[model samples]
Every structure is written in structure tokens, then in C-alpha cells.
Target: MFFKSSKINEFRLWGLLFTLFGMGLMILGTSGIVFWGQAGKWFAGVFMVIGMIAMLLSVGVYFWAGMLSTSAVILICPECNRHTKILGKTDRCMYCKTKLTLDPNEATDLDEGITEKA
Candidate 1:
């Protein structure tokens, strides 16, 4: 609840984290030359490979998120009146973080006390 985010946004956030981590690794790899002279080439190569793998994984995550976004149901949030996308039966508003659900049963349950408002 403290870190609520729409499913799509969560995916994007993870992708971004992966990208940043990969870039960091690549930079660290390149810096190996400054630390170990000629021997650093092997260390750099290994880190660079790992970095590339992370970058590729990020690309895949982004692609998956994009595909999911295309199919997500867009709805207007009752609390903020802003448009938000819902990925499943339950999700939070992208802007207001209001608890949302497509199921009527869940709605009542949320209304009882579990719902989160902006």
C-alpha cells in the first residue's frame, strides 16, 4: 500500500531500473582499465557481457509492458476524474492511487475499509 502503482507503471519502473543498472555496470566495466591496467580487459569484458544481458532484459520488459498497455482497459478514476489504465480486476489509479476494481464483489469489500484514497 505504501508503494502502490499501476501494474503497467510497475513494469516500466522495473525496466527503467534494469536500464540504469546495466548502464552503471557498463561504466564500472570501462573503469576497470583505470584500476588494473592491461589485466582489466578480461574483467571489463565479463562485466560488459553481464551489462549487455541486463540491458537486453530491460528491452524485453519494456516490450512486454508496451504490449500489455495496448490491451489494458482505460477508465476514468472516480476520485481524481483522471484517465487511468487497469490491468486486471484490481489496480490503483495512476495519478490518485485510489483503489479500483472491475469486480462488484471486490468493490464492496474495498468499501468496507480496505480501499485507499489519494
Candidate 2:
């Protein structure tokens, strides 16, 4: 299976990517600046629509990531034995894919959750 980072880290990385994508779109939309008046408005309008969409999406992603962070639980990775944070009911080791458990009743390898292990 492909390696995956902890849920929290993935969210953060996604948020950063969304922000950059929005900024890039906004920059591209401003290409009309060179033409000054004639074509600027038309180009700016077309670019602005797409750019605004990207920026709004980025803002939403950032907000969601921030909200998700509030519930993240800090734990020690079993494989690497290093301290790391994981989100949701299931998660994997930040450094290594060793299974972890929050509840004593449940088995170490949870069938469903965010991460595969601690």
C-alpha cells in the first residue's frame, strides 16, 4: 500500500496547497494589468471569476483544517516511538505505520479510522 501521512498533516498540507493555488489563480487573473484600460476589464473579469473561486476554496479548506486540528490527539508512535499528533478515530504513525489505540477495549489495529496506526 502507498504510504500516507497522519490525517492532521495531510489536512495541513492540503490547506497550504489550496492557498497557493488560489494565489496563483489570482495572479493569473491580474494579467489584464498590462493592457491598462481596453482589454483589462474583460480579462480581469474572466480571470477574477476563476481566481475568486480558487481563493474561496482555499479559505474553506483552511477553515476546515483549523477546525479539524482542534480535535487532534497527541500520541507516541509505536514503531518510531516518537511523539506525533493524529486526527480522527483512526490514524497511523507519523514516522512509521505502527497501529495504535486510544481505547483500551479496542484492538490496536482498528479496522476503520484516519490513520492505519500510530
Candidate 3:
């Protein structure tokens, strides 16, 4: 069977995961409030703190992903001639299983090719 790929899949997955995490954190924070009324001070405080940390992390992840989406380089795959965005130190061609590079001079370094392994 042939496999088809979609653009923005990774970013969308990250976004969905982060959003779910944020929602979960909000639920936990609400639980913490309820616990504060029942459980002793220390436990409730800990729960609230942990929930807040989760929320902050989720937000940071979402913001960072947004920045990455904007900054990621778009490339037309030489193998398939399909357009795709490359992110970070490495990425993959969404259409073809061909290795790609962000820097032509550093192309020899498989490790340095931003789209070497994708």
C-alpha cells in the first residue's frame, strides 16, 4: 500500500496535544480548589502549584510551536518536487522518501542536513 502524507501534521498534532493538556490542567486546577475546601492546606497548595505548572508548560509549548511554524523553512523536494516545511535540525520530505538539506555546502554531513532523516 502506498502512504500519503499531509502538511502541517506535526504542528497540528502538537497543537492538539497542547490544547488537551491545557484543558486537563484547568480541570486539575478546579479540583485543587475543591480540595482546598476539604483537604488540608498543604495538599491543596501542591495540587494548585502542579496544575499551574502544567498550564504554563502547555502555553509555552503552544507558543513555541507557533514560532516554529512561522520560522520553519519551506522547501520543494527535489525527489518529488513537493513543497514541505522543514523544522529544527532535521525534517523529512512529506511526499518523497528522499533526503534533503537546508545548506548545500553542509549537504555531505547527513547529521547536518535538516531534512536528512524525515
Candidate 4:
């Protein structure tokens, strides 16, 4: 299924995944694999560095996404009657994928999100 959420939500998800991946790498580095035994200290240090980089990237992404969210507009979806955040004038409902727009004149039924009553 397609991702059903606001753009900001998508960005946050990616950042969170990055954080989890970093955590995984850190765990692997410290897991004490036999091959790493020869230079375990150096190996662990490298892994820790890589993991920290990933974690830092995640934090930056999260901060940027959150900052962008501050400018997003929250609108109530007509289809689902739910509050949805819209960025850059056009967006879909987070719950129902209903296409919405800041420009009312631009709304049309040809799109998937907007359903016209027959």
C-alpha cells in the first residue's frame, strides 16, 4: 500500500528509520564477532563513529522536517471529516488519501482524492 500520511510524516518516518539503523550498527560493532577480535578496539571505534554519524543525520533530518511542518496548513478533509495537514497548497488526507488544495478553484473531481457525487 502507498504511504498514507502527510509529507512531514513521511520525512519523520525516514529520520526515525535512520536513527534505528544507526542503533543497529552500534549493536553490531559491539556484538564481538570473531573476525573483529584481532583489532576489536579499532573495529568497534569505527562502527561507533559510523553509527554516530547516522544518528546525527537522523537528528538533523528530524529537525528540518519539524521546522518545515511549522509552515504547513491544517485543513479538515471533506471526505473523512478529519483534520489533515497540508503543505505547499496541495496535499492528500492522511487517513483517506483525499486530495485537497488551498486553492478552491483548482479543486476538481477527475482526481482520485476528490470524489464527485453522481
Candidate 5:
């Protein structure tokens, strides 16, 4: 299991965006002030509902990521093995900073330094 700051940051960014969007919708829904008469009123209500859903989904994702972070296995890279966590897809060795790939074929294509015995 490896945790990368970049990936974490990416998740955080998405979570924040979702929450903000959701809040915006909720506020609009509550306000009930239409910008464009009856036609626009329906759209506003819809946006608010969708925003609420997005916020809820984002919260779930944040929780899931946190759980995964705690459960992931830690390994020392043989090449640059400095205690890095590997997640799904592909990861890099933290110590020597070797790029790690999940797929054996892709790893082979990426670099000769990569070994895919696992």
C-alpha cells in the first residue's frame, strides 16, 4: 500500500469541488428566487437537487479514500524502496524514485529497470 500526496490532493480537490457545488444547489433551492421567471425556476430547483446529491457522493468518496489509505500495505522498493504505499493501477517506488507500473506488459514497455515478478 502506497500513499502519494498527489493522488490525495487530487481526491481532496474533487471532494471540495463537489461539496461546494452541492452547497450552492442547496442554497438556491432554499432561496426559491428564480432568475428567469417560471421556466428558469424549475432549472434552479433541479440544480439544487443535483448539488445535494453530488455533495453526498463526494462525502462517501472521501470516506472511502480515507479507509483505503489506512488499509493499504506498505512496501520498500528494491530499487528506490523508501517506504511507499501502492494503490490501484500503478505506483512509483518512493526511495530511489523509480516509476512503478501495475501491469507487467506496461511496466516492461515503460522501462527496463522495472521487474514484474509479482
Candidate 6:
């Protein structure tokens, strides 16, 4: 399953990855001091700035996901019979990982793809 998650979960996952990446970059920047002594100050500053940008991007993504979640349509997954939110015309059951879609054409397409892969 390349992307077998609800849209909201996917967004949050990406946000988390961005946060981790940003933190790693910041830690790497601080480590410059250990490797280059006084000259590392410039190196640290550059990386720290880049890290901050990544962190900000993550924040934006989180905010956007949050907003989308609030506006998303809530439905019960036929497979799982559990509540899940649909972000766009298509999404998946968060629990059962069933491909779900509001459009009939998309649903058939998804089914055909699944059958082909299986």
C-alpha cells in the first residue's frame, strides 16, 4: 500500500515528518560548533535558519490539515462500519483501509485498480 491512509492522517503524517526533519536540521546546526570551533557559528546560523523555515512549513501544514479536518465530511465506512472523515471526492477508510469515494466513476476505477493489483 503506497498510500493507505485517510487523507487527514496522511496530512498529519507529512506534518510530523516535516517536524522531525526540522528538528534534525536544528540539531545538526548546533553540532557545527563541535566540528569547527568558532568558525561553526556561521554554519550553525545558516542551518538554524533553514531549520526554522522547515518548522514553519510544518506548522502551516498542520494548520491546514486541522482546518480541512474540521470541514471534512464524516461518514461510516462500509467495510469497518466505523466513523471516518472524507477530505475530497475520494479517500480511504481509516480503520479498514478500504478505498472510498463519493464519485461513482472513481469508485469503479479504484475497484478495477485493486482487482488488477490483486
Winner by lDDT: 1
Error of 5 at 61 (Å): 0.9
Estimate candidate 3's alpha-carbon lDDT, on a 0 to 1 scale.
0.62
Clashing pairs in 3: 92-118
Cα lDDT tens digits for candidate 2, 33-113: 665767687787877778777778778887887787776788887678798777655677767766565766655444555
Badly placed stretches (over 4 Å) of model 5 are 1-9, 24-43, 75-83, 93-98, 101-118
- Model 3, poorest ten-residue lDDT window? 1-10
lDDT for each residue of candidate 6 in 91-118, tens digit (9 for 90 to 100): 8888888888898776665487899999
Q: How high a TM-score does candidate 2 get? A: 0.66
Task: Report the error of model 4 at residue 16, Å.
Answer: 1.1
lDDT of 3 by residue, 1-118 (tens): 1222333445555556766766675566567557566554556566566666666776776677677778778989777888877765455676675555576654665455767666
TM-score of 1: 0.89
Model 1, position 97, has a per-residue lDDT of 83
| TM-score (all chains, Cα) for each model | 0.89, 0.66, 0.49, 0.78, 0.50, 0.85
Q: What C-alpha RMSD separates each model from the true structure? A: 4.3, 6.7, 8.4, 3.8, 7.0, 4.3
lDDT of 3 at 94: 60
Candidate 4: lDDT over CA atoms? Answer: 0.83
User: On a 0 to 1 TM-score scale, where does candidate 3 land against the true structure?
Assistant: 0.49
Candidate 4 on 39-98: residue-level lDDT in tens? 777777788889999999999999999898888888899989988888887777778887
The numbered model that scores best in TM-score is: 1
Ranking by lDDT: 1, 6, 4, 2, 5, 3
Q: Poorest 10 consecutive residues of model 5 by lDDT?
A: 1-10
Name the TM-score of candidate 4.
0.78
* Clashes per candidate (backbone, < 3 Å): 0, 7, 1, 0, 7, 0
Predicted structure 5, TM vs. truth:
0.50
Q: Which regions in candidate 4 have their CA more than 4 angstroms from the true location?
A: 1-4, 33-35, 104-106, 110-118
Best-to-worst TM-score order: 1, 6, 4, 2, 5, 3
